[model samples]
Target: MPKFFNTAGPCQSDIHYTLPTGDRLPQLEKLIAQRNYFVIHAPRQTGKTTAMLTLAQELTASGAYTAVLLSLEVGAVFPHDPGAAERAILDEWKQSIKFRLPENLYPPEWPDTNAGSMIGTLLSNWAKKASRPLVVFLDEIEALSDETLISVLRQLRSGYPNRPQGFPHSLALIGMRDVRDYKIAGGGSQRLNSSSPFNIKVESLTLQNFSLADVKNLYKQHTEATGQIFTPEAIERAFYLTDGQPWLVNAIARQATEVLAPDVATPITVDLINQAKEILIQRQDTHLDSLAERLREDRVKAVMQPILAGQDLPNVPNDDIQYLVDLGLCKIDNGQGLEIANPIYQEVLPRVLSYTTNASMGRIESRWLSDKGELMPMELLEAFLGFWKQHGEPLFKSTPYPEIAPHIVLMAFLHRVVNGGGTIEREYAIGSGRMDICLHYGKVILAMELKVWREGKRDPLDEGLQQLDKYLSGLNLDTGWLVIFDRRPDLLPLSDRTTTEIATSPAGRSIIVIRG
Candidate 1:
């Protein structure tokens, strides 16, 4: 029984290759020892459950406290009914404690209580009768919304004053978001204007993703156990693509080792990691698919729309931006600006947003492809112009985000071209004012830049040519295209405004300038 990379659930030490729990989070012994209640949050599958579960077991084993991690997720079905939710949640707690603790440490029988207060009552009685101090880690704390969420928070806060004598010595609320972001009611309303009921928490801490060093160490364990080698380049590439997100780190390794190169004698290389990444993105694994689902969320879209289009974030609420960060959709890069969390997410987000339009383009004629399957830049340009004249406006209505409909529709068209045998890599960021695409097919590569001319903005041809010149130099390509999507309200119809011309970049590269 050799250990393997785990992506499905909490890692089990004997069965999964994992970093030390102590390395993943700050020392909490002092807080628990002092009877402090705190919040622990992180994105889904980043090992919050594993860390807290292992910590609870280790603390109970130390003989100084009775500890266990339980979940409120099972109670989510009763979101509006606090009494039922509490009863269901308490039952799970009793079962967990019985399984995790010795008979001497088991909680006493529950008290008969009316309606919604059973959660607090049960905790108080359990703490009072325990041989040692009791510590509880409440997992999935965000599942309850509205009245149920408020009720649970207030109950936990009320029990804070009676610690070690009438209530648990320490309690931790664990979830994917900080308590303030929790929705307090229906209709997409958040807790923006209200004071939290669980205001007793001393600190709101987050479980961070693994670091590069942690990733290297975790992968090295697999080599040790199975004699399979992950090349240094592959390890760094995985970290770059996933940004050390726990599930993604494990998933990429699992896909490479288990599916792509199962033989221990076959060493994993950078190319294998890239192939594994494509497989993961195409398969839409549970982890990636769940994240893609958030692209349609209003809060998520508000922040993501601009980043995807290389525009500035304006008028978007700070809480909404933080919500995206908390969910691991985006990050404030180096305090410089907001960007997608990682490279893989950068790829996945646009592809998911353009899925419908991309799919609608069926059996695309390979006019831009040579007999050897190589791409031709001029052929691609002609094809795009013809497509824009015929179908661009109709497909614009098919895009997911209105702010970047032109970009999305364009990507959808390119996806059709790349879907056959090529790859399209995208690079865009907040305030860049343009999106860049590098299309690869066979031995041929095409570079392009996209800019939008909105109302009150000047023509972007000059700026676009200058930017494309810099971009072409980086790719060492002698020619590229600059597409300025004129989305001004006063513009003529799509058929009448679409046209193209040739120009020279500042660096003397041939630049194809398209205005549509």
Candidate 2:
């Protein structure tokens, strides 16, 4: 059978297009040789499990180490019962060893001990009995609750001094975050600790998303296996859309090859890649849905709300922002400012929050469309003005992120207009002070920039117009709209305050200044 893209779990080279797992982490052998107990973490689905598993196989095959990959996830189920969690975890570990290792390499039965300290004892016994030095990768270490996690980490730290002879020579704690960012809660406390119990880590290593070359090499595997070709533009577009996210990279190609364009001879194109993205978002695949779930987190909120409103970032802790970066929700930009990690996430974040509002909206007639079914820019603007005058206030209260409520309402309204037939691309970042949108409709492109006029702040009309001019230049458009929302107190009702005016940008671009 021809190999295809794998998105759900660790990639199997036999049936998946995979990069050499060792290429991504060249220091693993050196780290192991040094008897280091380190960490390897990245956002979910970025090939952590795949790399570790491959590394384990390679080390065991070389007869230099008795390597195994084990999971701590079972322990999460017994969060309050550390003893029970450890028993379950060790049982799972034994089963895993039975399946993965030869009889000579199998661990002796775990020593009988109190459940709380079983993991440490188990590893100690295994290393002592093994023919070669033992190396273990502990996966899903973050799933354990605070007390359980603390227990496990303390055990590992306690066992750290007994290397080579009594404990695993090298160990890796694998999860979605570095050791420092683990969310340790419960036990009647709601505060995060900066210094965790597992501070003995020699180093923390992160697996990066696939590079452009890595993505191309992966796609080439499919082309070599089958006659199907992915256009160079398609690969580049895929990389751009996903920012090299491994799951997304595979998902896009998988959808395009297996669903969007199944014929072996039909080459994948940029348009097909985009369609795959839309389909993935619409379907809310497990990977994307997992990320959407993080939006409600307080740490995630502190960083994300500013980006949504295009306001200056709040005084959030650096570690909080770094946590989001580790989770792949955001990334450090060229200038070290944080932004949404990729275009797909940029779209998913707003739409997921506005989902209920988008659904609750009452029936709206297609007043913005011309007789020929094309979107009329002026008509669309008028329709939005009418909607805002009628429903914007109530809709604002319906959203959780009030700072970006207006932006969400506007996006919700535009969502109704586009409805999958068109596309809306948003550009906003911390410190941008405005959100810019580019609407793509049938044979027409409309640009818009939204700013809020606060009571104590100066009206941003002039600044908005200047910014819109620069935005229009990029779109190669001669006209666009600058929407300034008047959020000042003592303002009249929406009907009275909402209005529009035609103005010109400094670069002579036609600007529709909508004051609402």
**Hey, what RMSD does candidate 1 come out at?**
1.5
Local accuracy of candidate 2 as per-residue lDDT tens digits, 121-230: 88888888889999999999888876778889899988888988999999999999877666567642343454457777888999999999999999998998998999
Model 1 regions lying over 4 Å from their true place: 192-195
Question: Tens digit of lDDT per residue, candidate 1, span 311-366?
Answer: 98889878888889899888887865889898888888899999988876566577
lDDT of 1: 0.88
Residue 303 in model 1: lDDT: 86
Give the top-scoring candidate (lDDT): 2
* TM-scores for candidates 1 onward, in order: 0.97, 0.97
- lDDT (Cα, 0-100) at 488 in candidate 1: 86
lDDT of 1 at 414: 88
